[model samples]
Target: MVTLTPLEAELLEVAGSVPDPELPVLTLRELGVLRAVHVRDADAVEVELTPTYTGCPAVEAMSQDIERALHAHGVRKVTVRTVLTPAWSTDDISAEGRRKLREFGIAPPRTRSASEPVSLTLGPTRTHPSEAPADAPIRCPHCGSADTELLSRFSSTACKALRRCLACREPFDHFKEL
Candidate 1:
C-alpha cells in the first residue's frame, strides 16, 4: 500500500473536497472524479481526474475548482490532469455519494445484477433497453414509492433522466448508470 505524507494528505483532502459544478451536492471524492494526488516537489502537487463523460462541460470548472482549493490550502503550485483511459463508471460513485444524490432530490443509479446485460446510451437521442422498463419499478426519492414514470431520457444533465412520481406527483432526476 502507498502511504501519504502530511502535506500530501492535506492536499488530497483539499482537492477532493472540490465539488462538481453541475452536481453541487457531491464532492470530487464522492463522485470518484478525483483519482490521485501526487506531490511533485516541495511546493508543487499534481492531481489526476476522470470526467464522467468525454464532453462533460463541468470538467473544466471542476479542474479550476481543484486548483483553487489546493491553493487555498497553501499549495504553491497545482497541476490538474484529465485521465480517460480507464473511463468513468457509475460504479465509481461511492455509497455516500449515492445517498447524497438521493437526499438532493436525485434518484441514485440502480444497481444491476451480474446476470443483467449492460446497455449503453451515448446521447440524449439514444435509448437503452436496460433503462427503467415500463414493468420495472423506479422508486421515488421523496415519496419512497415505486410508482414512477420516466418523463424523458435526459434530464438537466446527460448523466441523469427525468422522472416523476405518481404517488407524490413530484418530478425528479434519476442518475443514469453508465
Candidate 2:
C-alpha cells in the first residue's frame, strides 16, 4: 500500500495554489515548476522545483511563498530546492496554461517541432518581430497579427518581450519563445 503524510499532501495542495508571479493565470503546477513534494521526518517539508528561466527573478519570491505556505499548513520547517538539470521550456507549459495565457492577452510560446533547436531566426541579420525562426512564428495575442514589430527584446516581465501590432499599432507583450 502507498502512503503519504498529512504534511506532504498539504504541501502538494499549497504548492498547487501558488501562481506564477509573471503569469498569474498559471499555477506553479500548471507551469510544471512544482516537480515534487516530500516530508522529511515529522516537522520538515521539502519541495523540488525548477524556474522557467535561469535568471528569473521570481525564484526568490517563489521560494519564500512556498515556505510561507508550508508553514501555514503546520509544517515547522520548509526547504525549497531548485532543479535545473532538465531545463524548463515553453513545452512544459500545460495546455490549460497556454489557453490561460491567450485569454490573458499574452500569446503562448511558439512550438518547436521535433528534432530541432529552440532557436528563433528573425532574418538574415537582425531579428524582427514578424520574422520568427524558421520553425516558430510568434502570434500577437492582442490583434492576432503575424505582422508585428519587435519593440524591445525585453518587456515589463522577463518571460515576455515588448512588441507592437502592425495592424493596430498597439503595444503588446509576446511571451519569449525561449
lDDT of each: 0.86, 0.77
Candidate 2 TM-score, true structure as reference: 0.81
Best by TM-score: 1
Name the candidate that leads on lDDT: 1
Q: How well is each residue in 1-178 modelled by candidate 2, as lDDT tens digits?
A: 4476775676798986788776778888887788778888789778988988787789998888888877887889889999996888877777888878888877777766657776555546334644554445566787787777777778888778777777877777777766
Each model's TM-score, in the order given? 0.86, 0.81
Per-residue lDDT, model 2, residue 16, is 68
RMSD of each: 3.5, 3.4
Off by over 4 Å in 2: 1-10, 114-130, 133-135
**Per-residue lDDT of model 1, residues 112-150, tens digit only:** 665677776565542333454655466789988887777
Worst 10 residues of 1 by lDDT: 123-132
Candidate 2 residue-wise lDDT at 135: 46
The global Cα lDDT (0 to 1) of model 1 is 0.86
